[model samples]
Target: MRVKDSATDPNAIAVDSPAGTASPRVAAPRTGGGTLLAALGVAAFSLTFPATVWALEGLGPWSVTTCRMVLAGLLAGACLLAGRVRPPARRHLLPLLTVAGGTVVGFPLLTTLALRTSSTSHAAVVVGLLPLTTAAYSAVRTRAGHSRTFWAAALTGAAVVIAFAVRESGGRPTTGDLFLFGALLVCAAGYSEGGRLARELPGWQVIAWALVLCLPVASAGAALSLRTEPVHLTGHAVAGLLWLAVGSQFVGLWIWYRGMAAIGVARASQLQLAQPLLTLVWSVLLLGERLGPAAPVAAVAVLVCIGVTQRTRS
Candidate 1:
């Protein structure tokens, strides 16, 4: 997920950054550190699906989702308090809520639910669409115009992802597939909104504030989930849960949004093209899942499409 500034011209394409912040425009040069930061963020996120799967072995999806949020929120709150950060301006409240709803609530819940039925490998393929979705949301939010080549590349990538899903599921969509798709959309929106706010607020602070904002809801949900499901935590499950709370939800966004703020959303988002491949590797190594011959082919195709889309001018 990412955020940035809006364009003055309705037809002009601009990357979202904080107002008064400097970020590379589409044609501008990108910094090496920004690219590396974005890559690191992707590497962190790549483990999310598999980790969630490991977590589910000992906990219900609701338990994992809500507990992760509550824990991460507490960490974020501590960060805020330690930094002595003032509350956001009243005007910033709604966007922070948007970030909270999509990422803090929607993405984790939906993906965890999806993982109940879907393999980690399949979910990784679905998540491959995230960069494209984030780009689309950024385009709409910024009211930016895209060239025909850009749209064609974006549509082509979408088509490839859809086809891969269909082929994987024996030509029929599964419940997990639907849930993962929903996760992709909501996460994209959250990323875009958070990236936008990162311009004015520090990237870490943007997610920290969003997490803190949702703490009450997260606490309630976690309590209710535990009451209903009664998780018996194992060492692996505990590790998985902590990874989600600290690595993916908190530190990952700290790096990701900063990369987006520095390099612009478009370029930063492109780095996520590597995410699916990394996820596939993690799934096989960590989860002991076997990769089919088709998996690598699909991953390469998706990466090529993403590269094409990234190169197209908006």
Candidate 2:
């Protein structure tokens, strides 16, 4: 998880093109609006897991994930058509393919599978480790300077969350929890790399190519799953699946990646902290799940960890 701070890199403000109209250039200043928008994106995504779980009662996880991607891809394709976004250059095809597989196909498949056994709370707890995982990956990959205190705090927070989740899961980690954690680690890598690519490529274009690249994989998965387990159609299930496909996947991502491109990955990721908290809220309101007495405790601890990790000199 990263924040999209323009303060760190003035060059990221805009992409200049030959057909451009005259535009003014200036030093990137801090904007509270970016943070606010990022917060909204996180809030939207927080509803995603619980929404998936709720929808999953009727639609299977694979079906749900596939449908979501398919709808999102189509929506993105439409946007591309309307905006006249160009296709990727031949040289860029391979890198785009790699990101498509990692970000769209692999991450969603693993996460949807995880949601099958794990409660929304369980998944949230594991995914809350994303800040640590992302920071570690960034440090190793870029050799970026970050504080030891930040890492220590992130590590401690992750440990505490894991401990609580394990206790909640009856001392044994569920397959779902493990899958969620593993997916977070893998997806964070893709997200970091993809964000780097956004420096040279348009945000929607990257995702458009990725979704196109992922279509075959998603189609194959859908075909295989549908062969044995036909999706039973019910009104509630259909409605839920529609929400997953259109609202969560398509609408949510359109805002998310665009915002990430406009800002920066680190700052964009700061919005991610809201996801777990929103999941908790949705679970309580929609699913009637209780966070028990540990809700406030977990909330405070997580916020502190995020604050610690966010203490960057850059």
Candidate 3:
């Protein structure tokens, strides 16, 4: 689940540092470090949604969400146990829990279920609203000055949804779309809060502890679901599950948190503008989904919104 693009990508820590004339000697190393980390964060983040969709082909969204968090929790916990990283302080528990509950638990649960009925293309289109939602959230908090461009971008994003309904197979979104929308909203809120807190906490510590808190919750949900609905395992399913658990959940988050820490929340969220576009690309490639006439128009609209959000924030 994409949280609002954060300027504080936890992963960017290794890469970026303050420019102080007093620290001239460290400049070269900091620059190199920031560059590498930023690159890695970009690469890792790009794969998350596509990987989620790929995993969905085989595993139920609930199972995928549960397994990914459980495995990531274990992996992160092991690293923490080995002194590779440390846990958060007692006072930080609430924030950590919030991040875990919102991102690891809420977003995945909703997104997975959404994918059950909606096409990945539609999911991407709907998710394109995240930036706008984040902007709207910011508007509520800061009441920042607005512009005509801002409203235009916001309108375009809304247009994407309206367009979808017009072309919608049954002339309306299914129940799953509503579910995904709710999940996406939760995720937007998570991004806002998580990015804010990430400024203070180390990336690994946040993810590790957050996952630790989320593990039992996800596990219990999965187990209960399993009783009523048996998981159908296929070769694709097994591979997708493992991939999401290992790649997106464990490794991807490790880098993501780091990126959040390095840059800051708002700026990092900009990286997410790439995600929906990438999803569109992946859908065409992997799922054989077509873009049709709406493709270019949607692309322009999303890009314009991205620009609007950046300008408004800047």
Candidate 4:
């Protein structure tokens, strides 16, 4: 989540040392393509909150969440089948399940429900905390060391986000705020787990397998939700749903994992700092949400804290 310099050289090939030598091989610097791919992934993800709000105009949150996951699962199944990838080993099964539950079920469902009451602008600002959360999860899972400065910056960023949430909710936390907080925590766990898995498997394969693993539950939920809430799909809603299914769920993760694998998670995740601003823009333009003066000021403060966190190291 905290951005760092790329860990390896994408263009470098491993050169064999002398037969008796035990020197480790060094990787070349990463290419510019990795940065571009990461940027594209962030761009796709930035629209998610706003798009969910739009889709909710014509469909219930449960229906929208379930349908999006089911659709994305179908596409993931197709990719796995076409790629002729074998099922993951037993050790990987649990991590894959974590990814499935976190990204496919927890994050989308909670955020969809959250948008029912919270404006996209508020949600976008709150999402500014994701990079810090993701970094914390990654550090914990990997047993990586971090400096006190890093912790200080991350905590400050999180505190700023919490303050913004409180201000937006009139000094009291709303149900939507709780939902969004849950979404943030689960999504951070998923992103960290998926990044670790991407080192062992193809990035797309990791997500595809996770999606396929959750297919049965997602399909059932979609059917049950549809039965309970009659869907009246409008043009805007359809477009929003399609974007969520294809871009946010599938394409974004595919490119994101590739970028993470190529440049390392910390460096690649830095690109996500742009997501809140991009989401705010989408909310204002596409969803016609009005931005208050406090929004920009809070966003800048959060971004500054994030930058500081990214630059500090263990």
Considering every candidate listed, which one attains the maximal TM-score?
A: 1
lDDT of 1 by residue, 104-133 (tens): 889999989988987776676566678778
Residues 34-96, model 3: lDDT tens digits = 334544654564455667777766566666787787777788778778875555556567767
User: Each candidate's lDDT (Cα)?
Assistant: 0.76, 0.63, 0.60, 0.74
Relative to the unseen true structure, what is the C-alpha lDDT of residue 210 in candidate 2, on a scale of 0 to 100? 75
Question: How would you encode candidate 4's per-residue C-alpha lDDT over 166-274 as one tens digit per residue?
Answer: 5654565556888888988998888877766665667788888888888899889889999998788999899899999999998898878776666556545555666
Model 4 worst lDDT run, 10 consecutive residues:
1-10
What lDDT tens digits, residue by residue, belong to model 2 across residues 97-155? 65666567666777779888877777776556665675566556655555567557767
**CA-only RMSD, every prediction:** 4.7, 4.9, 6.7, 5.4
Q: Model 1 off-target regions past 4 Å?
A: 1-30, 161-172
Model 2: colliding residue pairs: 2-266, 2-267, 2-269, 3-266, 3-267, 3-268, 4-264, 4-267, 4-268
lDDT of 2: 0.63
